[model samples]
Target: MKPKVIRALGVVSALLFLGVLIAFAQPKGETVKVKGEVVDLWCFLEGGDRGADHKQCAISCAKAGNPIGLVTEKDEVYVMMGLKDHQPGKEVLLEKMAETVTVEGTLVKKGGVQVIYVSSVK
Candidate 1:
């Protein structure tokens, strides 16, 4: 093959490899439903804070723009995001803070952190 043709082929091969890597790196969102208690990240991580009794405080923190987290029955915790139009937006999580809830949304795990883009909470 001509040298120039070989170089072009190599470039194309490199681009294809990069595309594959990116696809694996960023996975598409998948619908998920989990039962857990939504908690204010601050108190939850610091003092083991939780329980329906702490509902008011958890809601307050969340309303104040604090990060919200969910603790599942298996003791797994995940960062929760209220997504609207593909961005962080409206939330049904704050009101359920510190209370057991069943939520449905897209679950994503990256960089060792679990995040759920919340859609509905009940």
Candidate 2:
């Protein structure tokens, strides 16, 4: 095999490995104090109203493992999850649905969708 071809193959291999590393890298989210109402993202996205009135249904959806988000006063919804073990925590959010609460966590953005990884919820 030609020396140039061998060098080119090595370069390609390195690039592929770099790509894999980037793919596996944990995304970084800015730490923020987010004050909002826990909401069922499925309902919020579908033009459903969320407030004291929708509390029961929102809690039900959250309890059922549906997508949950924090709907800020500005009307922005951020998908919420527990930072511990990097998994969703619907139980912590179930009763808080449609109620105002403060969440401190890292805000991460992927594929144009914003998500907040909660370190603590209150």
Clashes of 1: 0
Candidate 2 overall lDDT versus native: 0.83
Clashing pairs in 2: none
- For 1-122, candidate 1 gives per-residue lDDT tens digits of 69999999999999999988877654358889989888898889999889977778887887777788889989899888775533331166766677788888888888999888887888
lDDT of 2 by residue, 11-120 (tens): 99999999988766545768999999888988888876699998888888877778899988898889988775557758467768888999998898889898888878
Give the number of colliding residue pairs in candidate 2.
0
- Candidate lDDT values, in order: 0.79, 0.83
Q: TM-scores of all models?
A: 0.70, 0.73
After the best TM-score superposition of candidate 1, give how far the Cα of residue 23 lies from its true spot, in angstroms: 15
